[model samples]
Target chain A: MIIAEQKPIQEIKAMIASYQKILVVGCGTCVTVCMAGGEKEVGIIATSLRMALRLDGKKPEITEDCIQRQCEWEFVDALKDRISKVDAILSSACGVGVQALAERFPDKPVYPALNTTFMGMPEKHGLWIETCRGCGSCELGRFGGICPIARCSKGLLNGPCGGSQDGKCEVSKEMDCGWQLIYGRLKTLNQLDQVEEILPPKDWSTDRDKGQRRILREDVYYEQTV
Target chain B: MAEFEPKLIAFCCINCPSSSVTVCESMGMSIPTNVEVVRVPCTGRVDILHLLKAIESGADGVYVAGCSDGNCQFTDGNVKANRRIERVKKLLDEIGVGGQRVEMYRMSAAMGPRFAEVAREMTERVRGLGPSPLRR
Candidate 1:
């Protein structure tokens, strides 16, 4: 899932300072699961903004609303009535959702209230760790289900680097060397011989090297002959 | 200008502070008139939104009173509430509202006097801070 964190209130306040009437939108999907932007968070942000503005002697009209998924047009369409009532929008969704809303309503000013951090899952309560870089590639089968691209400090493809010490990465003592983990997993599975064959360089073009990428599934695409 | 009597709100866990409130009342002790006690199943149920809404709705100060640390009826409820309180405090400070307005306290159901003491302490602290700036 996409994980994000709410931006500092000061920064959000500054962004909407010029607008007296504002709508705070929350996404009920990824951001909701991460506890950054959701229905509950929408109320919190709105109330905090109101209190802050009131303290500044500003009589701002702030409204709170949340949709099932901000990235979907149908879900975002539910907010049309509320969107029309406000001068600006403070989206507490990921960057994609914010952009979707902006594209849907080009006339209104849309501002992001969260910094989209990474594609990851919660390790524990209130703790999210990055797991995937979305490099447009999948090679987990070759590395004992661990992707070096995302976990390795240097994104090394083969065995552990010289910097790896006591199974810990050179980047930080707390960070486990990704290759070391791969080695350990492979050893447990009696597949340590797999590491002897050096792997080829990754295909960079499949990633950001080719600019924005998209998947076109002809099977899923529908067309009307009429 | 008239003396400011800060409106304070306390989110007390039903298992502990609520019992403490009853015990305090039985002992002929009463909470301040300006302070309102809201009972919840657990301190963990007290979302940040609730705290912000209370302040926005004219609460000069707000605090969560739950079971002492490990004694939470729901096990880590108080601990979770403590983290949320800290987050809310940082948010309040960032929004120009002093973080001191919000706080968290823990005590067992047997401590009736401690409950009253917290009320007095919070009321006195808020009184010194003055009415909530958001108050109309």
Candidate 2:
């Protein structure tokens, strides 16, 4: 899921400072799962903003709302009525959600309340770590189910780098070496032979190196009118 | 000039801290009128939002009273509460609200006198810091 963390209260305040009445919107999906930009978080950030703004002596009117999935057209479209009432929008969703709202409502100024961090999952309660880079390629079957491209300090495809020490990455002791994790997993699975085969350089075109990747499924589209 | 009486909110855990407050009341130990005691099933129930909301809604200071370390009925409820209290304190400091405005106290159900002591302590602390700038 797309992980995000709410921007500092001061940053958020500045984003909508010019607008008197603002609506704080939350996404009910990934950001909610990370406990950053969920419905409950919306209430918290909204209340904080109200108090923060009051301290500035700007008694701006602020309101809160959360959509089912901010990335979807239908869910964000439902906010049309609410959007009409507010001067601007402070979106507490991921970057994608923020863009979706901005694209949907070209007239209103939309600002992000969160810094969309990464494609990740919670390692434990209240702790989220990046797990995928969404590199637009899947070779997990060859690397024991972990993506070195996302987890390694250097997206090494062949094996661990010299920086790997005792299964920990040189970048940070707290971070486990991604290639080490893969090596361990393959050893346990008796598939260490997979590492002997050196993988060719990944096709840069398949990744974000190519501008704005998209998938147009002709099968999913409606038939042309007669 | 009038004396600044800080408006305070205390989220008390029912098992120990609340009982201690009840005992204090039964013994005619007067709690500071400035403090409002809010009973909760556990200190862990108190979230960052709850503490922030208290300050936003005119509380000059806020606190949580829970069981002593390793003594929560739910085993780790008070620990969880401490983490949230610390987080709120950091957030308050970041927001220029003064983290000293919020605190956490630990005591058992039998510590009746201690409950009143904590109430007085928090009241004085808030008084020292002056009323919250964000107080409504």
Model number with the top TM-score: 2
| C-alpha-based local distance difference test score of model 2 | 0.91
TM-score (0 to 1) of chain B for each candidate: 0.96, 0.96
lDDT of 1 by residue, A37-141 (tens): 999888888888887777778889998889999998888888888899899999999999999999999999999999999998987887887888998889888
Model 2 has a DockQ score of 0.64
DockQ per model, Cα? 0.80, 0.64
TM-score of 2: 0.97
Error of 2 at B104 (Å): 1.0
| TM of each candidate vs. truth | 0.94, 0.97
Indicate which candidate wins on lDDT: 2
Q: Across residues B43-72, which tens digit of lDDT does each residue of candidate 2 receive?
A: 989998999999988899999999998999
lDDT accuracy of residue A96 in candidate 1:
98
True contacts kept of each: 0.93, 0.40
Kindly report which residue stretches of model 1 are placed more than 4 angstroms away from their true locations once superposed: A222-226
